[model samples]
Target: MKGLVYKGNNTVKLQEEPMPKVEAPTDAVIRMTKTTICGSDLHIQRGHVPTVPVGRILGHEGVGVIEEVGPSVKSFKKGDKVLITAISSCAACGYCRRGMNSHCHTGGWMLGNTLGGTQAEYVKVAHADSSLYALPAGVDEGALVMLSDIFPTGLECGVICSKVQPGSTVVIVGAGPVGLAALITSQLYSPSQIIVIDMDENRLSVARDLGAHHTINNASGVAEAAAAVLKLTDGIGCDSVIEAVGVPASFELCQKIIAPGGMLANVGVHGASASLHLEDLWHHNIGITMGLVDTVTVPMLLKLVAAKRLDPSKLITHRFKFADMEKAYATFGDAAKHKALKVLIEYD
Candidate 1:
């Protein structure tokens, strides 16, 4: 077996590795079908996520087929096509009982740094019954790959956390895969207006096609961008704002554009310290919430995909083979940062 190993300081290498086996009673062995490089992966590669260990098999989002099941795994059997939830959880925990699987008492993401991840030919899935979702028959790998992370992440952060509703005005900062997924999912609420902000025009165009009512290239100045958004809202602020970039500037933009009493969902993973204007947020009475997205909403997202109400495939603009994992990393990690959206690393 081969996996992409993080070599540290913005480096990745493809190396032959031993295949994974069931390590726990609740574990399952998955044959990787489609795995992907996420913006978060870039964070780890760039040394932003210092917690990630060196030589770690680096990947989280995966769609695969169950090759073997542990003794206690009951919900799935070998040969079941499944989506690996990025966040690993013990479904029996108190937090999980409250639908906060990302914060399960057991752990989230037993793979990757903590263990071997889905970047290889096979991966050990911990708490399989709770973490893996069976994919619907006939769904292609391209469409379901993101369910493991990006899609569900966006839907949870952009749609659920923001509490988007019909006739509500919303602003989403960032146009990356997760941000674009947010753009698409935000439409489900039939929001009267959806504004997408990004420095990339290509991404903003995709956001527009995905149902954003307006798009802004926040390249010049924040005040200018905020003014444009304000004008669109008839001088009022948007009802909900989603900060998807995980950067200080984008998070501040979310706060700046939010309407009084609006809800602000910070979906980005902050890699560095970010300062906030507490006085402004306090005066506006804005509600702020942030979290690692749990897989609780995956079932609903799967239904939407099955019903054809949502199409996540539009964002997968690049593909790679497992053997070409190095190239995939280089392309996604650098070259395609601006041009490509989601890059899938395929396996048998």
Candidate 2:
């Protein structure tokens, strides 16, 4: 088998690798049908995620058919079409009991991070019963691929954490895939405004088409963007500000735009330290929250996709065959140049 590998020092390579087999009673071996590179993969490739071992298979989002299941796996059988969640969870753990699957005792985000990932023809999934979702009939694979990470991630870590309320002003920093996911899901709360900010005008255009009430291009600088955000909110700032871009500048913009008593929800997987101006925030009574994705909302998201209420396909701006994954990575890694949102890597 061949898998996308992180070769350390800001590099990625496609290499031939041994096939995976069920490693535990709770595991399942999946034949990767469709996968996509994640923003975190870029973090790992750049050595931002230092814990990722060299030569690790690097992907955790995909949809596939179950090739085999361990003895303990009961909810799924061989040949079941499934959505592979990025995070693995032992449903029996204390964290899992609290719906915090991202911190499951035996398995939490092990795929592509601590273990082999879905960037190959076959990869092993731990705690299969809790981590894999059986694809609903007629469900779009491309949409399910989005469900594997960004949707639930954006909803959980962004919208839910921000405490978005009806008629509240919401500003999301970053118009990347997860940012757009938050833009899409934030509509559910009927926020009076959905403002999206980014450096890329193309992405901001996409954000507008996908329902953002306003879009700002900060290519000039943050000072300009902050002024624009304040102007949009009539100098009050936003009620909910979501930081979906992992860079410090974007996170700082999120902090700047949040109103008094507003929530700043961080969905970005930061690789560096960003300052928190606590002195300025303490007097404002603001709230801040961040976390790894738990993906507990996948089932409900599945129903929305099935009902055609949420079209995850809007985020997929490019596609490639599994053989062309290298090129796909290049395209995704340089998303701005390619004007790419999500690049779907699939098997024929």
Candidate 3:
């Protein structure tokens, strides 16, 4: 088997590796069929995620077939097609019971971080029953791959956490994949306005096509962007502000454009500390929420896809064979240059 291995100091290499087997009572070995690179993978490569040691396989989103399942795995068996979740949960842990599977004591984001991931011919999945979803017949595998991470992250962290409601005004800071996911899902609540801000005009254009009522290019700077947002909102600011870019400036922009009593949801995976302007926000009665994706909504999302209410496949902008894993990473890494959103990597 061949897998993409992360080498420290901003490097990754595709190398031949031994096949994975079921190693625990609750484990299952998946023969990957389709997978995609995530922004988090780029973060890991850039040395932002220190816990990810060298030699770790670099992926957490994909669809695969169950090659083998341990004795304790009952919900799935050999030959079942499944969607691999980015976060793993025991479903018996305290955090899991609270629906915070991303913090599950025994399993939370182990794949592509602390454990081998799905960017290979075969990858081991822990807590198999809780971490994998059986694929519905005839669904697009490329779209299912989006379900494994970005879509859920956007729905849970950006839309749900921010409390987007009907007739409310919303602004998403970042037009990246996760931001676009948030843009697409936020419409489910029929927010009166959906404004997306990004430095890239190409991404902003895509946001418009995906239903953003307004788009702003933040290239001029935060003040100008905020002014533009304020103008769009009639100087009232947005009812809900979602920060989807994992950067200090983007987070700051979210703070600047939130309504007095608005909710600010931080969906970005920040690798560095971002300042919270408590002094300025003291009189504003605003709410702030951020956390890793628990993927508790995968089932509901699947239903939406089945019903044709949501089309995640629109996020896919490129595809590559398993052997072209390196090229996939390159394209995804230079996303702006390639106008790429999501790059799907498939196995034979």
Per-residue lDDT of candidate 1, residues 71-143 (tens digit): 9999999999999988988889899999888888886856675778888888888999989988987777778
Q: What is the lDDT of every predicted structure here?
A: 0.85, 0.92, 0.94
Candidate 2 per-residue C-alpha lDDT over 1-348 given as tens digits, one digit per residue, 9 for 90 to 100: 999999998888888999999978999999999999998898898888878999899999999999999999999999899999999999998999999999998988898999999888899999999999999999779889999899998899999899999999999998899999999999988999999999888999999999998999998888899999999999989999999988899888887889999999999877789999887788988999999889999999999999999999999999899988888888998999999999999888
Model 1 misplacement above 4 A: 335-338
Error of 2 at 147 (Å): 0.6
- The residue pairs found clashing in candidate 1 are 88-109
Tens digits of per-residue lDDT for model 3 on 223-334? 9999999999989899899999988988988999999999999999877899999988889999999999999999999989878899999999999998999899999999
Instruction: Give residue 329's lDDT in candidate 3 (0 to 100).
Output: 90
Candidate 2 runs further than 4 Å off: none
Question: What TM-score do all the candidates reach, one by one?
Answer: 0.97, 0.97, 0.98
How large an RMSD does model 1 have? 1.4
Q: Which candidate is the best by TM-score?
A: 3
lDDT of 3 at 11: 92
Question: Model 3 off-target regions past 4 Å?
Answer: none
